[model samples]
Target: MDTTLVIRAKDVHMEFPVKNGPSVVALERINLEVPKGQLTALIGPDGAGKTTFMRLLCGLLDKTSGELDVLGLDVEAHSQEVQNLLSYMPQKFGLYEDLSVAENMNLYADLHGIPMGERPERFQKLLEMTGLSEFTSRLAGKLSGGMKQKLGLACTLVRSPDLLILDEPTVGVDPLSRRELWAILKHLVHDEHLSVFVSTAYMDEAAMCEKVYIMNHGRFLGQGTPAELSAIASGRCFEVKPLPGVAMRVLQSFLLADSRITDAVPSNGAVRFITTEPNLEIAWLVKQGMTPVPVEERLEDSFMILLKDDEQELAASSLVIFADSETETAVEIEESQVPKSDTDMPQLDYLHLTGQTIADDAPIDIEVENLVKQFGDFTAVANTSFQVRQGEVFGLLGPNGAGKTTTFRMLCGLLPSTSGVLNVAGVNLRHARTQARANIGYVAQKFSLYDTLTVYENLRFFGGAYGLYGDALERRIYEIMDEFGLTDKKDEDTSQLPGGYKQRLSMAAGLIHCPKILFLDEPTSGIDPLARRNFWQQITRLSAQGTTIIITTHFMDEAEYCDRFMIQDKGRLLILGSPADIREQVQLPKADMNEIFIEIVERARDKGAM
Candidate 1:
């Protein structure tokens, strides 16, 4: 009932009937209030009701119970009015592919009824702000992922709505692009006093918000600023640095073996664990007969501690209910009915390479010399050169439109280089495109698999296209399906699969041919962290078997998995070395790869690299 609140929800509940009986609650007793002209972030893992809440706020979905209001209007009763003052950018914004950037802007301007006199200036400013001026004539479909996101943001801002709802706006955007988007958002808030509500999986972005609502399984668990929420673990955290080559899984097991441990999570190079008793301190080093070093808690540690507390409380309540059963005849299920292990599950190995050995003398898998790709007068990639040694995990790291994909496409023979020497498996890809392509595997940035096809059928078609047939194809397909944990869902239509499974299927299809080298173009884009870890495991295993990998990723953590990399900016190579080397060059003490990447890109821009 606060007068300054632009969005107010009270005991909101949304449910959908399922087959057989009970309705699935997508939102349960959710209550929230957003003050005017403030940035509020909704943070959670996948299937956490973030999207459901956003849809409800935009009046795209109706609440099953309770009241919801936005901009002083009832969401359900004054839906039209609410819609007029709110702008929504769904995860998959409906951007027209065939239209040029300028044409797309014009179409949105018309749809929003933007005044003609103000259109030019507004469009020009947006273009300049988003760095899309040069790409105005390019088709929206041809734009890079980050550029497309910026365009979507620009289109949504055309009418200057009072409330902006962005669902995972920066999901796959590069750090530089994300920072730019944040800057523009700050400007909008400061200059126009606009209220912003955005949903994101990135914790870093959540930290930037004035307030954050943490949701899980359609329920609001907590709400507060970053510092306030992080204070939940104020005195209960401990950091442990394991010896070299000590797997996180092993460390996690060691922590969980102790009843005193409340939660454990891997961060950076250490494992942060929280204890049940805040005053309890265990010198793990002393217990293990080793030296100990002082450690500190992080925001992630606090979040995990809170999550674990919720889980334990739920488990305890369930146990009490079972103990109070009315039927005397009912056999006491005891602990047998409960899961023997933690239901929260252990984190998967993001990078796991088995004893699969690489041939020492295998030929250079990929070789590029002075590669140049130009679109009219603009050079997308200029004088780029690199080589992927046999069994190596190579990476192309760059900001949006820094020509990473262009270079990748040229290597894959999807695009002919304007000028330069390129070879894949020692064959000139430009001249022997088909032959070179036959020896390589590729997964594009977007979901490239057919939507209507079932998982099995998609794999079948891709396998056949790669020249696999009969028992060999069938055997390979099943092996891959099992390997990627898609065996049971093979009959399910691909489009019906979750975002993570779709990514897994894409990876399986790409590897069906068992090519000597694999090219992954942002292969983990839009997938959750757990799925990304699984995908990386597959990649690392392939690499260990001498299947060279050329990966492009915006996730800096993923970049750490690469053995060597080339960092590019505006079609020029900025740093080319090992991940450790790049980190060292950045020289930001205690900075992770993401921070280092941001600093490098900004520094380069200031030096006129962009």
Candidate 2:
């Protein structure tokens, strides 16, 4: 073992056995070295064996074959010693909801056998660093999504382990909290000389690390500095904008469907795309009356191109794509057609609507007037108002305790407002709550389905609760199962399914009733890039068929899919506009959604808006 290397793996392979068949290979030929006192990032698409590798390093799972070394010790042979020198934080961080923030930290400190004499100094520093000094006595359950994440990090840092393994620590956190978390990690590396290994799905976070290892199918595809990997697409990236009077959505659709284009995504009133044909010239876009400009490549540009190339290579080799199970197949969907349902329903007619047809004149589907919600002396939301039009995808954004979810619950009829005019689909919720709720579907942030029940059983129960019975319920269940590609796994227990499959099942249950409006809360929080793409494709199809969608998410990039977005802070509405409009309104020329969000929120705070 090299003295400078904190962790090393040589020809490592991991496999799980089946009942009566071949073993499943999760990781193979994994060779890597992490330098001491530096930050290393491990990233991959969903189900790419990221968590498995983390588990192996933490000694929670025994490796089937190969050698693993942590701090110059064999992990398998000295598992107990290895575990004592490191900390691991899983996706769903374990926090005692009933205990106060201070109590939770004290418990972890005791578990690590920290001296009581040094506790005060360490606790003070951590509390100040994580901005939780003011909430020490607050119960963990009362903290917001971002606060709980910060507390979890504090607990893991109690002993100052030699190595820290964090698995998606910022999955459901807001942009501001994420920025703070990264700041803390950077400080630790520079001041304390801590060696950190973290896995994340966000490309921006991965770019900030000193070294990044891209993992797929249990193998490392690329390993280098951020700049080294970004050079992969140095000359192939271009920014294209629509001609005068042409809509950005129209141009985005054309580019995404073009065979020459590898990946096209909407960003700031333009489409950023990479080409399969390296020799394509700028004159081609000019001839088509579109403005094209050369732009600097970012980490995401390289990641998308690399993943697409890998998929094509796998197809040519006749190897199974990702997984051999039917559940992993990418379902191709048509944008022009509505979902074929047995019941009579109207579609949104997206293929036929032009820019003028989708303007503010469209019929209003949701209305909020002077909405206010209070608990004791605390005001969660105050005097907020917004409207969403029919067949539109609307996004609600805010900081962790900025009242985004509270507003969402009121719109879904799960919580009532103190005093306001809350209406959905022309029905006032205060007077006709049942009638208004009957037309909306909801997917909660956390998993809310039955764990022991099979996929089919869960779906059938939800369908029946929505008023379907007998053959109708059965037919609807089968239709949704087929639509989401869940038919073959209907007999599998919901808790045992993969993370991606569980997400699909949750979505299937929400759409069983075919409500006029859909409410989604952080629907794609921790899934891989491919799963997120598939999820948005389904949302686009539903919008084309006239389903109004109101969603709240922490992933800033997903805001590109919203027709309009509203940002709130301290229960006050701050900004509401299109992605392009928000940037232009804030006077930031070429910033992405994440930067724009930070700037707006900071500006508001400096001016006492929060």
Most accurate candidate by TM-score: 2
What does candidate 2's lDDT look like per residue over 1-610, in tens digits?
A: 6779889999999999977889999999799999999999998887789999999998999999998999888999999999999988898888999999999999999999999999999999999999999999999999988899999999999888999999999998999999999999999898999999999988889999999998877888888999998888787788897654344544444454444666666776677888765545544456556666777887777887777776642222222222212243332324332222213111223323532124678789999999999987999999999899987889999889999899999999989899989999999998888999789898999867999999999999998888889998999999999777799989989987877788889888999999999999999998766567667766765776678889998988778778789999888899998776787899986777888888988989999944
Candidate 2, residue 281: Cα displacement in angstroms equals 4.2
Q: In order, how many clashes per candidate?
A: 0, 3
TM value for model 2? 0.92
Q: Give the alpha carbon lDDT tens digit for every residue of 338-381 in model 1.
A: 22334422222311222212334657788888989899999999
Q: Score every model by TM-score.
A: 0.80, 0.92
* Residue 123 Cα positional deviation in candidate 2, in Å, after optimal superposition: 1.2
For model 2, what is the error of residue 304's alpha carbon versus the real structure, in angstroms, after optimal superposition?
A: 1.5
Among these predictions, the greatest lDDT belongs to 2
**TM-score between candidate 1 and the true structure:** 0.80
